[model samples]
Target chain A: MENKVLMKGNEAIAEAAIRAGCRHYFGYPITPQTELAAYMAKRMPKINGTFLQAESEIAAINMVYGVAGTGKRVMTSSSSPGISLKQEGISYIAGSDLPCLIVNVQRGGPGLGGIQPSQSDYFQATKGGGHGDYHLIVLAPSSVQEMADLTALGFDLADKYRMPAMLLADGTIGQMMEPVVLAEEKEISKVNKPWAVTGTEMKREHNIINSLYLAPDELEQKNFERYEKYKVVEENEARYESFMMEDAEYCVVAFGIAARVSKNAVVAARKQGIKVGLIRPITLWPFPKKAIADAASKVKGFLSVELSTGQMIEDIKLAENCKVPVELCCRVGGMIMSPDEVLGSIKKLMGGAK
Target chain B: MTTEILIAGFGGQGILFAGKFLANKGLLEGRNLSWLPSYGPEMRGGTANCSVVLSDDPIGSPIVTNPDVLIVMNLPSLDKYENAVKTGGTIFVDSTLIKRKVNRTDVNVCYIPATALAQQNDMPTLANMIMIGKVIGECQVVKMDGMEDAVNKIVSARHAALKEINLKALKIGNDYKE
Candidate 1:
């Protein structure tokens, strides 16, 4: 389709959203992710789409909520601190069952940590950042191409489930540039907004978009219904990639940029006859528990590589049912772990020292 | 084959742009590639750098600790990254800006007066492209024919005339004797 183009990951996500029929983008500027909003600001006008830089991240997510309720494709993006501001809005979006996209190009963290690449927000993203008994459909992109592919996928998933979807990316993936073959533009006409609050004139009754339920039983029923949908999502939406698992003694479990580095470590280890493989989770919310479990049954041990103090390790342990020994090799506070370091960890798992 | 490259220089020296050009060239060759920059404060007139990976197979990591090739424009970059180049790897230093000799005898070192060449050729602020040209020519990381097309796509339409100058700079580095 002559669609291959060299672009930064953040810019690709913005372009992909446009192609995915997302005509509205409301975001406050933040490092590592500012390019995405900037691209939308420049291109949205020409395409007759809406791109508004809100006063704050909170306002931006609410803007997404408003546009999404009208059954239009809308999205907002932020970095770590800014994402925290949008959490309340995101929770409300989930509670109201509005379909939208939220992109979190994470940097170092607790509070304005640093402007370097980090995956510390793994828990915040997959465990529902805002709160309540809800889960976000989280998709993590390892490369610039995946950054684009997953943005379109996030929109599709959000629409299909009537829930908010997130593209969980780190600073490295957000700022990096690579070749990408973009997706075909989706026809906005096909997106049905029948339940939207687009004003019911004389044809039907009023459509109210509200999350507040005063009655206890009504709220309980709504929660049950949402959980039912979540179960369906978990069953059908688990996405992952398994690399060189056949006849391997141990496995490395990682996601996003960490997974990218872990793959190099695995490749290097294989060259030395270490028998190490990699299991990458593309969908962080569904968490790809089965992939890890299958590998756990065959492999002797597992190593969790991350850019944090090791949050995803808990998930790996639970997924593996704590059957195999799972160790962590990580670098925290926006620091990236080198391939050699990860390779050393894999070698240790193989019961040897390099 | 896989080529992991690290390009570093001062903030205004076009280090990121050099990485981008090579990355685009790699893409044009239908190879898997990734370009990751060291963003934030390090880019605030300090030592800015980026990692570029080009491979026949899918790239595992966009970041590299020991690069197969290292391109440095300033003295600080050379000092910081000289030891990071792998044994038998190539290190391209900007002789115009750096006067000190390479400390390592194990790796291949190419000292090109890129800044001086750019200043002398009436094309200032093109040392990065010159180093890129030299690297591509020396390392054979990507084809030299892909340079012009990559420049055309990267440079804005308003600066279309710069394409010719960029190609000329690239040729200077590619055809360098030393």
Candidate 2:
């Protein structure tokens, strides 16, 4: 067994990014995710990296945009409200087709809701937070281990696809500490970036990186090309975890902390002779639609458990094409549903079926 | 077996630190464990708590809504979580700070003068460790054999000298009578 070190989820993401050859980190401090920035501030200088605390979240994301244009791995992290401030820059980055990592260690919010963990930012993240038609590859990590693993994966996927990737995590996973075996640091074989804005020095045509396409025909052409890339991502990048779905009669859809809670409920419900299971989506954007669609033909009902009012339920409904009955079990305003509460929902599904 | 432990007290009373030490000890024993602190806009004297889970199987939820072992340093914590413990679970209290007794009859309750013991032992800031010591001593959720190593891992090198005193406080609480 490899040596496992216990770490908070926020710290794990920072360390993994460093190991993934991300040397430029720019962010403003926010609650629940301040530790990631603090870790970068401490480690970046020692390793000859750039760690700048920008004046605002807007400035921080623009800095990410600037570094990304140069083709060096770069990232910025913030909680929900701060993320809201960075949406314009995010849209700009996506519009320019630049690759970078953006982390939203989400907190409860409509307007500075609370500093506690929440998954209410689901629509803003998956449906495009910044406006204009674009999707940032979104990865949801349920554990401290995935928090590290997905940071590395997010950077790779973003670079491979030439777009921004978002690690959409909530405050609980960001604050929780669990044992994680980090990948051994290896030499990073970076992808070739012929499109990078490295100065030509009169050798060739000057490379230009810009998002402005004032001509309607040109802008429409760009959008069509980006959607083609998104189509490839949707087919190849969708990821999820299926627990006890082999013989399940009911299905529970959740992600991140809510999934962890639902897993416990599934186990307990099984012991009580309820054949329920869980489908935890690892990538929120390229959602595991096929998994839910397959389960729809078999399961009696679907329960969407969330820390938000009811966000992911819509996706589950669309995935199954409403073939199975879908219901919502949720809490909001910084409240998390307990395992027993989820168990009750599972039992209710069973009772309704009978 | 899985043990869900909830330790609650004020922000600066080492509530989260004690949870981290127990979690590190569980890791040393090769048990799956998670430590989730209750983080918010909390100041030094504000309410603070953390949930620690150690299990032989893979852990599911990091949150411990119904703790098998509850440790409270202040009255507010006890008031908030006293009834949330499992039917046969144990509740450890710091008698020096919380003057009230456990109101529930179904659960086992042990009241130790942890703050008093820490102050008397000249480790004024270690009441949380003393409470944890009593928890492990009575419940035996984790053995005491690997505790020294756990402390070494949790306390950073800059605070190396404080490690010995922390172990001493644990020993005092572990061996305390009544």
Candidate 3:
């Protein structure tokens, strides 16, 4: 029987990761997502897993990098500002094709912005956050349940693609309490980590894991291989949700908390006869462009609603290629837009009682 | 049907815990539900609130822009959210903390001296629990059996010593016919 147990989103991530066969964790405390680190610190000792609160996010992410190089399912989570510090490490992980999970329970940003929930990291998440030309498989989770579900899926996808995977959640989803069914403890035998580094003690073909390929041709070949894997990821992993779009002329496109808010606005607008729907992108990197482009063909316009002022709307407009009138409704600096606010934007777009 | 509620109060008021109980009840009843709370600096000395969405269909947004119900344990919450409740929604005010009326006739308003009632039960910490009882009593959004199961699970996991008090708080709420 699926029983309800109230748990914070941060706690959910820790519990979920552990259940997903992650016995290694490294993180630094940051507002909105600190509870996750704290929970792991307390629980990892009991589970015989290693949990380390690094001096900084960069250090933590590098810690993830070192562990991941050996192929142990590992994770490191932080808020927006701290996530920025980990960009270098993330780029290294991407370049090395290391499989790891990075949870960014996003807060308002640009610089130590407030610690409120904000979906401002749309571009950072989708555009291969760090420098370099590689991309991380980014998944945006809307609920605490997804906080668990996606963390598990992230590990699977990371292993499947041999790349870094991210859970792009907002601070609200991190801090909230919700009933999440703890996934069954995974069997020890199920941990598939043939790619791990357990002390080169294989005594068979010395395992040399190094990112430094001084030979130009060899580095080029490795880059091409990683690119091919990314190509596969993009082609197969585009995920999104469409609501009431079959008969609707106007729709809102959003993700994460913004998607949740827009969904209500669309539902409420529909009640007023405005024929509205919502398109929520689940995977932002592979970006459900076909869905949004297809939506452009069916709908008169798309309203890009988010917690950041016009950041993700850029992607929607780019995807639609101006085929449809793509308007934007947004909130920034940790402020959340109300349903009334969203509905007002939708109504005005539909030429309703604005 | 989907029932959306926003429970707001101070951090120590157990507003989040009560919201969790309601969301848990919905889950126990096999309903789709979520509970989300304020984060970061707003969580410090500021008013903390949680949005609880209980729906028959899979919940679209855990974040309710305009809640169908608003339960305020303090005055700041009432002032901040009073104008945002749906026209036909319900507003429950803790008269022990909030003195002003919501002043909107479109919404059903209930005045429960929640803190006083908890004090009457000899445990001030049960104020939020009492409020939870009253909310479930007034709305009856979840089955009584579901609520019982939820309360037993939550109180036992949360504060084992206060489990009996929380159960009694629910009983007082269940017994409130009005």
Candidate 4:
């Protein structure tokens, strides 16, 4: 009894969070992701949830921190520029080991780039966007269904690790409509937040949630502990999808919408008897290294198709051990790469390698 | 077996709904599917479009650059996407809007009078549904029954009463032997 419903990725995410037991949403209206805020504004009141349109992205993220500090499920979202505004707040929340979901429906950037979908925030999302020694568990969703499912997972992982997690989607996925089989949500138990400062009575002592460890040794221990947690995440949370990778000679490495287009490109290439395949990373931070590395033995080379000035190319290069050459098909600034363009790149790589 | 399609037209022409219907039929048929759209400032009283990919395997990219099928509801969309149709692919143009035929000989062209059919049925709003039916008929990407289910699923929330008209529109076009 799977019931399919067609919905935009942004609205789907808002509804999914509600189903996932989120009681509070704090955010600003940013293009390519405004539907989420609008959905929240319309639905939050009905569910007795607080949907606060904060004056700035900074204010919005801090509101999320305050709500999450109370041990309630909470979230915030924005596009790339707005996300940049919230970075400092993101760092503080991460430093305090708060459990919250931050959704970034990324658009082109470096500055106020454009509203078109782009994956330019890869490095910023995975490798710490703010000033600090911290990391956010980044989940890359390639479709509207994932947009809903991953927002739920984002909250779950955040609560599990007692750190902030991010749903790193792009504008294309956000605005798109698709038939999504919305899953039945898991129950949210009254969570344990011993770190919360609800107030200290005469019987209990005062509690503190701070990231300021002035002592270098204490800070180092916290950093090391975070690294240990990240290692656990890398081991257990690395996710990717493979398409016809078994017994294939050529593979394309892509994420988000680029992955979707490459899927078609690979199919077209395969129809031409080229034996092409694809590897899609769902978790960009963990890098899906094991999967990509495993691909090296089966495929001659990996084609890194991205919507940037070749940002994810660095990750592809790092994942391989000189066993296979990684090629780049880069596009940026609100420009979408055609499947033929990707196939052309693949053909070039295959011609040179074979 | 993957079937990728692009549904393009004006903002009010039901292009997004058409793509969603195609993707819904994929779901009904137990296939992996995806429906991706293009919208923003450009959708305000302007042209809009979406790419819907239906396949037996897990759909990789939903953004279709070169689609196996392109359903053009208007002229701008035909111009925007005519070159992107795969060689030997099928192009379904609304005879009401696109007066000239697609000149390419490598692909098959379906000249369905979607607007004409809608107006003749006295239900002008179902033109997009007519186009969807034409897409299903010409491409056979999804079954008509499956498309009916898709329509029910798509229109249930907002326009439940409009389903019958849409289904009738589909039956008219799907039954058209042309």
Highest TM-score: give the candidate number: 2
Across A240-322, the per-residue lDDT of candidate 1 in tens digits comes to: 98899998889899999999989888988889988888889999998999989989889999999999898999999999997
Query: Mind giving the per-residue lDDT tens digits that candidate 4 earns over A1-83?
Result: 47877688998999899988997999999999999999999999998999999999999999998888877899999999999
Interface RMSD of each: 0.8, 0.6, 2.2, 2.3
Top candidate on lDDT is 2
Each prediction's TM-score versus the true structure:
0.97, 0.99, 0.91, 0.89
- Kindly list the per-residue Cα lDDT of model 2 for residues B49-125, writing each as its tens digit: 99999999999999999999999999999999998999999999999999989999999999999999999989999
lDDT per residue as tens, model 2, A221-313:
999999999999999999999999999999999999999999999999999998999999999999899999999999999999998989989
Tens digits of per-residue lDDT, candidate 1, B8-52, equal 989989999898888888878888898999888765478899999
User: Scoring only the second chain, what is candidate 2's TM-score?
Assistant: 0.99
| Candidate 3 stretches greater than 4 Å from native | A1-4, A187-196, A199-204, A214-217, A351-354, B42-46, B145-148, B157-159, B173-178
Query: Residue A146 in model 2: shift from native, Å?
Result: 0.4
Model 2: residue A347 alpha-carbon error in angstroms: 2.2
Per-residue alpha-carbon lDDT of candidate 3 for residues B15-127, written as tens digits (9 for 90 to 100)? 87888788778777778888887654555457788899898887766776678989999888898899989989999888888988788889998888888888887888778
- The reply for model 1, stretches above 4 Å from the true place, is A189-191, A352-354, B42-44
Q: State the weakest 10-residue window (summed lDDT) of model 2 chain A.
A: A183-192
Q: What overall lDDT goes with each candidate model? A: 0.91, 0.94, 0.84, 0.86
Q: Judged by lDDT relative to the true structure, which candidate is superior, 3 or 4?
A: 4
What is the lDDT, from 0 to 100, of the residue A121 in candidate 2?
93
List pairs with backbone clashes in candidate 2.
Answer: none
Candidate 3: what lDDT?
0.84
